[model samples]
Target: KEPKEQGDAKEQGNDDNSTEEPVTAISEDNVKDQSIPSPTPPTPPPQ
Candidate 1:
């Protein structure tokens, strides 16, 4: 159940990144903090 939940959350984050830049930033930080291993689409370097 935990793994399934995490997988769904990760996919949700990936999808959210498209419609919400703020959410994408937060999601990226969460991903790093959680040490999520899923491959995410390349995010351009922050300026």
Candidate 2:
């Protein structure tokens, strides 16, 4: 019984870890995709 319980706990831990990589990858891609520089400030009217 103890061994079965341990196995179940380990399986659940692995499942939690498995989802982290994809989420991290997606967030990183989103940041990279928005790397464009902000638009230049509008030029002031000629003095």
Candidate 3:
């Protein structure tokens, strides 16, 4: 039952993920542009 519930939740999350992706894309583009010279994406993920 627990496993089934988690599976359903993950499946449902995929539907909502599209809406969330644009926000992330905007942020990623902004960060990529600002830190083009530096590797902030990798650096921030670690910290």
Candidate 4:
């Protein structure tokens, strides 16, 4: 019974670790996309 419990815990840990990397990669990509320069604002019309 102890061995079975240990195996289940290890499997859950592995699943959690596998999901973390992709989340980190997507977050990094979002940061990079946001860093790009945007178009300049148009000049205000004369008053």
Q: Provide the lowest-lDDT 10-residue window in model 4.
A: 38-47
lDDT string for model 3 (1-47, tens) is 99999999998899789869988999999988888757756778787
Each candidate's root-mean-square deviation in Å?
A: 16.4, 5.6, 11.0, 5.1
Q: lDDT per prediction? A: 0.75, 0.77, 0.86, 0.79
Per-residue error at 17 for model 4, in Å?
1.3
Over 1-47, each residue of candidate 1 has an lDDT whose tens digit, in order, gives 89999999999988787769877789889979666444333333332
Candidate 4 lDDT over 17-44, as tens digits, reads 9899889999998877766433222333
Q: Could you give candidate 2's per-residue lDDT for residues 7-40 as a string of tens digits?
A: 9999999988989988999999887766632222
TM-score (C-alpha, index-matched) for candidate 2: 0.51
Q: Which candidate gets the maximum TM-score versus the true structure?
A: 2
Q: How many residue pairs clash (N, CA or C atoms closer than 3 angstroms) in each of the candidate models, in the order given?
A: 0, 0, 0, 0
Candidate 1 lDDT score relative to the true structure: 0.75
Clash tally for model 3: 0
Question: Which of candidates 1 and 3 reaches a greater lDDT?
Answer: 3
Per-candidate TM-scores read 0.36, 0.51, 0.36, 0.50
